[model samples]
Target: MSLSLFIKYIHLFALGLLGCYLLRYYGDLNPVLASVLCGLLFSFLPFQSFIKSTKGQGAIYAGTFAAMSSSRVLNSINDFVLVCILGGLILTLFEGRFEGLGGRKGMIAFLAVAAFYMYRSVL
Candidate 1:
């Protein structure tokens, strides 16, 4: 597979695992906010160089946040803005809750996004 595709798959897998973790622990969190917190933590964490040396981790987090909020608003512009807002809210709500689990947060964010998409499609 091409490098980009490979990276995307890996990111997707990471998100899936994150979702499982969230389900196991903090599934009660609002999906949109959880995704934002996950994205922010993943982006800012200094462990990028030690493992998975790619900026895609940040993208995965951001994408998950976006996906989670995509269902609430239909307008494309509004959707993007809402995603960011939701993410921020999540970060604020669960501040310092998962200090050492950036990866787990990412998975939860992914699951939230997936759940949003699933709900949107079903309705």
Candidate 2:
């Protein structure tokens, strides 16, 4: 497979595993719910939207790591930083204007990162 396709598959697999973890621990739902939720969260909605709308596939690819991080597969500041950086990358890439980022966009990003970390902590 091409490098890009390989990476995409890896991301999908990671997303699937994340779904499994979340359903088992966080969602406390059935296995079928895992597939449905992961499909909606990772494949159909946010990540896929990024792939369609921008050249920031790298950011999407990177941001998907947040799911893996949420799975508690790794525990480190580095993983947190990775999610933060990639979240910023996505915001910058899509918005195409970085000025006054300490305003609305920055707050949104902060909230998103905070929410992810909070959810992971609870799981």
Best by TM-score: 1
Q: Write the per-residue lDDT of candidate 2 for residues 1-123, one digit (tens) a residue.
A: 244644443343344444545665577766445545654555445545535443334333334334433345335545454445435544444444545443443343344456657666787
Question: Lowest summed lDDT over 10 consecutive residues: which window, candidate 1?
Answer: 82-91
Candidate 2 residue 33 Cα shift, in angstroms, is: 1.8
Output the worst ten-in-a-row residue range by lDDT, candidate 2.
Answer: 54-63
Residues 1-96, candidate 1, lDDT per residue (tens digit)?
244444443454355235423532356566666665665566576654522434355435544544443334433543343334333334334434
lDDT of each: 0.46, 0.46
Model 2 earns a TM-score of 0.35
